[model samples]
Target: MTQRYSVLLWLTGGLVVLFLIAPILAIMPLSFNSEPFFTYPMPGLSLRWYEEFFTSNVWLMSLKNSLIVAVCATILATFLGTLAAIGLARKECPVRGLIMAILISPMIVPIVVSAVGIYYAFAAVGLLNSLTGLILAHTALGAPFVLITVSASLAGFDYNLMRAAANLGARPHTATLQIMLPMIAPGVFSGALFAFATSFDEVVVALFLTGSEERTLPKQMWSGVREQLSPTIAAVATMLILLSTLLLIVMLWLQNRAEKQKQRLEG
Candidate 1:
């Protein structure tokens, strides 16, 4: 009976995973469809869409812009989020709940509303239609994820470790850098990856903040879908799917590593 139940659970989980991933996986073969349309049973396998995706100047530039914004936003978001998380984790921090609510409100708020507000704010500062504006906007959108992950990691941290480091003549910042940061490295990295993914795939903010010169890959994809629905989009989507899968794998590994580290620390 137990064996049957175990088999049923495994099969159920497998089906759920397949259901979630099927749509994404379905696009991969369509990307290689020889005909421009996304029809089943392939007109014949071809690499034309992939070639176009690689060789097109517009596609390349959009990809470049996305990478630049995502990287910059990831760095800024991670730094700010880590500091914010650390502050919030402190028992004595003033109005921690209120402050955290504000910090992570971006995650709860509708992105379109945020983008509209950001657009007006950027316009006032003359930052609209630029990479800088896009980076800043993406940073706001990404920072909450970083904060959440780091805070969860910090939950298991031992304050005594910090005190011991301080007693050894280390400064507060030094202790944080050398001791606390190392222990939470996996969370920090995982959060940064999430931040990068958020920024990389973000489109609404980019649509509002960026111009032709600063168009990111997602914005480009959006435009393509709206204007032409090109098979090149399928190609790009497949590549992005692969990238997303890689990031997911890395996050899972980091989470597992953090669990093992926490066990060791607890033991």
Candidate 2:
């Protein structure tokens, strides 16, 4: 009976995975379609759409904007979130739970609601429709993931090591850089990947916050889908899928490394 149940669970899990991935798998082939439309049963396969994406100024600019925004947001989120995590992990930190809840509120709140609020707030300050505004919004959204990951990493941390470093005449900053930073590096990197992916793939907030000049890749894709169903969008989607897969692999590797580090520390 146990064996039968295990097989049934595997089948159910496989179906769920297939359901999630099928659309992504279906679009990849259409990217190479010679025709402009996204329909299947292609007349012939060509890399024309991919070539268009690479060569087109608008698409290239959008790609550049996405890279810039994502990189900036990742760095900001990782730094702020790691600091917040360290503070929250401390036993004597004041109002720790409340502060943590506020920090991560973006993750809990509906994104549309968050976007609307941000739009008005930025508008009041003349920050709307700018790269700075978009980066700030993305940093808010991405920071929670960093906080959660780094906090988990800190859960296994030994505060005694910090004390030992102090006893050995090390400054606090030196201890953090040489000791705590190395231990939590994997989680920090994993969180950075999540933060980058979040900023890169974000659409709704980008639509609300950005002007034409500040458009990101996802924003450009949204415009293409609405204006005309271009096979170029499919090509872009395929490239994004490849990028996401690579990030996912790296995140998994970092997670495994973190686990091994934890085991070593415990042992």
Candidate 3:
């Protein structure tokens, strides 16, 4: 009975995987379809959509804006998140739970609620429809991911190492930069990568905060889909899938490296 159940579980899991991947897999080949609309079996294969995606200034400009926002958000989120993680890892802080809850509150709050609040706030500050404003908004939303990853890494960290460095007359800042930073580098990198991905893919806040000049790739794709169901979006989606897969592989490598380093240090 147990063996039968295990086989059943494996089969069920396989179906779930297929369910999740089938739609995404459908997009790639459909992008190559010569059909004017989204459909199966291209009248013929062509790269016209991809070519359009590359050459169109609207699409290209949105891609550039997305990259800029992602990069800026990654930097800000990583810095702020890493610092918060380090501060929390110190046992001396009172009300650490409260602090952590506050830090991660953004993740728990509904995106729509946050978006509404941010929209009004940015409008008041004249940050609405601006790239800098979009970047800042994304950074705020993405920071929680970085904080979670770094905090998980630091949970296994040895405080004794910090004490040793301090005892050796290394200043706190020096110890952090030279020792702690190196030790947690993998987590930091993974966190930053995740931040970049989150910012790159985000749409809700972008819809609220951005305009024609600052519209991200996702927002542009969204509008295209709404207006005319362009198959060029399928091509863009395929590219995003490829990009996300590459980032995922990098994140997995960083995680594995961090685990190995942790073992070596602990051993």
lDDT of 3 by residue, 14-130 (tens): 999999999998888989988777876678898999999999999999999999999999999999999999998878988999999988888899999999999999999999989
Window of ten residues with lowest summed lDDT in model 2 = 34-43
Stretches > 4 Å off in candidate 2: none
Over the stretch 168-257, how does candidate 1's per-residue lDDT look in tens digits?
Answer: 999999999999999999999999999999999999999999888998999999999999999999999999999999999999999999
The lDDT for every candidate, in the order shown, is: 0.95, 0.95, 0.92
lDDT: the better of candidates 2 and 3: 2
Q: Output the lDDT of residue 199, model 2.
A: 98
| Residue-level error in angstroms, candidate 3, position 97 | 1.2
Question: Which pairs clash in model 1?
Answer: none
Candidate 2 residue 186 C-alpha distance from true site, Å: 0.5
Candidate 2 yields a Cα-based lDDT of: 0.95
lDDT for 222 (candidate 3) = 91
